[model samples]
Target: MAGIKALISLSFGGAVGLMFLMLGCALPVYDEYWPLFVLFFYVLSPIPYCVSRRVTDDTDATSNACKELAVFLTTGIVVSAFGLPVIFARVHVIAWGACALVVTGNIVIFATILGFFLVFGSSDDFSWQQW
Candidate 1:
């Protein structure tokens, strides 16, 4: 499960990065807005590594994974919140509204990650009986 998460996260991150880079070079009007995507990419960048560690059987790996997950989610929320106004002010209405799509996607991702963490943490043996 975590491996799948890691792969998806990395793929999404890479696509976002490449898209921003291309946008920065190809579109002068959107250059300033490109940085917004760059920052968002960075905020989401740790998810792959965190999810990779998350599925490990080792205690240390699990601890680090939890920490990384917490950091990624926390930073993501903070970055998005701060960037929202800036994004709204700088981009066109249509482009700015696209942020809602971004936000909804990110929220789903974070919820999945956090739910797994919570479920694992609450269980003694990671069994369904705990639920």
Candidate 2:
């Protein structure tokens, strides 16, 4: 099914992203675990949106305060995720090369998250809730 295929692709993307993250942190040249803090951002990024969705009612208003706040919080989390590596690099806690790799990983992981929502957040027959 399409949903199954989408799930598989998303999983692959997440795995690839995490691979990049791990490479940045665990590579002999970098050898710094400071970049691992971005994993917290990755975990926190979706919480606001999920919470808001659960607390608010779906309506045709085209805009909702709860959703907007959630988006804002999500944006902050994403920005924080991207910024942490740069901060680490600036402080010499990690190498610039590692920062670049971590940033790349963040991009891939966030894109995969967006793709998951786009694919499974629909009101169609194949909602992610089914899984």
Q: Highest lDDT among the candidates is held by which one?
A: 2
Worst ten in a row by lDDT for model 1: 93-102
Please report the TM-score between candidate 2 and the true structure. Answer: 0.96
Model 2 vs truth, CA RMSD: 1.0
- The alpha-carbon deviation from the true structure for residue 58 of candidate 1, after best TM-score superposition, in angstroms, is 18
- Report backbone clashes per prediction: 0, 0
Highest TM-score against the true fold, candidate:
2
Off by over 4 Å in 1: 1-78, 81-89, 92-94, 127-131
What tens digits encode model 1's per-residue C-alpha lDDT throughout 1-131?
Answer: 76456546655755664453455434544334433443554456445545544565565443565556657766766567446634664655325434444454444444444554454544465532344
Residue 131 accuracy (lDDT) in model 1: 42
lDDT of each: 0.50, 0.93
Assess every candidate by TM-score. Answer: 0.35, 0.96
Question: Which residue pairs show collisions in model 2?
Answer: none
Shift of residue 84 alpha carbon in model 1, Å: 6.2
